[model samples]
Target: MKFAQPWGRQRLSFLLEKAASREAQTWRGYVAKKQTSQDADVSPAQRDEAVRWLTELHGRLQLYPETLVLAVSILDRFLAPIKVRPKYLRCIAVACFFLAAKTCEEDECVPSLKELAASSNCGCSPSEILRMERLILDKLDWDLHTATALDFLHIFHAMATASRSGFLDSIGLNRSQHLGLLTRRLYACLADHALMQLRGSVLALALISLELETCCPDWLALTIDLLRKAQMDSSALIRSRELVSRSLSTPRASLPPNTVYIYHPLQLAAPARRPLGTMETPRDQPALPQAAAGEESKAPPPSPKHLAHLQKVPLRCKASTKRKVEQMDVDDFYDGIKRLYNEDATSAVHEGATPGGGAYSGGSSPCPPLQPVGAS
Candidate 1:
């Protein structure tokens, strides 16, 4: 969504100031030490794994991207001052997630503690998470609201859009679509503990800069303008951009190539019903005579019934196949919309359907169907 004009510039300035002031106070990175050390600390790998776990839970729970960002911010902030044991890291992480949800999410939208614990599978009981939450609150001084990288990202993206107006249009994405893509990339950067050393504003700007460079010819000018406004060091941003670029561009592990075996349910359900040695050939069909060792055997021709059945099959594509293909495309479109909006498109479609589980008929509509925005 585009921010309102006039106030948009002022709001951006205000958020930049607030974030700059709070960034140093909130920024925290843990020392990656061996778990077996006498003073055990959260390792980088463990922290990344925990963040990945939270990311997965965030998608599964359908929580807002803001919630996940805030949760990670909280986790880092809490871990910065306090030295948590490696064993209790999961519990702490889960507690921070819960606390961030309570702070950023609506009262009705926040999941119950019991539900969060069970869903996250963080190896912590609800009571244990409650205890950790209390400890975290005490450590953080009950301040859960902090301007995260995501917050800065929103401000920067809005400012960029406001300045250019038609930049995203050229890229074939509306504001929401582009922002959603950047948000996902930011999430990936957050999972890497290496980028945690950089300030939130610098990291956010670096990501935006990298994206702008690919699409906007005047990306350097925009970057310098944002840097001046944010009061960020150019060198730091450059280093961050390099690190973020490398982190983002790093190849993901793919599954090894293997043949996929598909089994039909009906075949598996009654496997024993058909004896292994049994042949289903009709008795009326005579078997081919045994040929000489060097000769090829001739098989019987098809029966009239079989030929008739084969002739009945259409050569062209079936209507059902076309429908299936159309449905697949429709599903892909809705999936993109769901990623953009984080809404349950399936439930929305179900709600839009008729009571008889059919398409809408000629009548007054209860609600209008969702339309794609700025689709190319």
Candidate 2:
């Protein structure tokens, strides 16, 4: 005789509740008061630059999406209390991600320090990264299990799939397949810094709405109320849902096709798409030149393009260093992408197009209209 499965709606809810409590502990740790005197003098723009650098670095390394999320959470928690110069921030991010990989990824999957240095191009040395790792671990008192938005996603997905409900039937999806798509879309949202303030559960719940909304327009309002009952701030949940929705809808050339999500669990999903063979460093743009004996290399400052992308708001720099280009705030950037899709969808709707040709057309993946960011 077969044993009964221990999963169902009630069981899943109990698990989510437990995970939420654990996640709250992690959030409290993240939001703990920082010592003002030791806090970094850097602007939000500066911190965003560091986050962007890590985004590119994680992409090049072809690490799992959760690795990137864990790395960023680690970086922000470390940076919250200490003041480091702008130049050193990139090194700190590299170290944070490296440490995070060791915790979240398999031994063979984690990239070596030399590989990371080659991939990043920001001129961080292995020694510098190692030093930063030590500093981060000690500063946080050696706790590496900080809960992240991805953590909550795992619980939520398991619950939604455990039962054979009308919700899944109405959407016309396989439990595993849809969960994979949702996970990919969830990773896309983590790329933005604006939604970083929302809790992991709130973000996960919003993503559920985002995926379901394509088929069930009424689903979002219902989800909003459900999350509110779970003790999330209603206003914040709505705003987070919108941001997640926008990020998912944005069209980026770098997004992965849906096939990539079919084979693995979210935790061990395939690595992001990467550049062709050979991880050689470029000679012309070395960020850190080799140093003399007994000297450590300094962290290289961010490139102009990277800095501009992260600045979200315009800054008045000296003429010698100014960039004469239009500035798009982070919110506007995602919103702009979202708007493009909306126009196309609107036009298709007006034309009375069928499902395949319409905005909700099932293209490469049934996940969402939003593309998954490429591994690199």
Off by over 4 Å in 1: 1-7, 29-39, 253-376
- Best model number under TM-score: 1
Error of 2 at 169 (Å): 5.9
Q: Against the hidden reference, what TM-scores do the models get?
A: 0.64, 0.56
lDDT of 1 by residue, 1-376 (tens): 2333434688779978988888777666555544566447777777888888788889888878888999998888888765677899899989989988888778998999999998888888999999999999999889887778988998898888888766787899987889898998998898888888887888899989999998888999999999999987889998999999988887541111243668876545532233211223335766444564125312222224423343332222223666556545544654554445434424444335544344443345666654446967
Q: State the weakest 10-residue window (summed lDDT) of model 1.
A: 270-279
Q: Total backbone clashes of model 2?
A: 3
149-238 per-residue lDDT for model 2 (tens digits): 776776555544443245777777856657667766665666555666777788887887666566554665556545754577778767
| lDDT at residue 77 of model 1 (Cα atoms) | 81
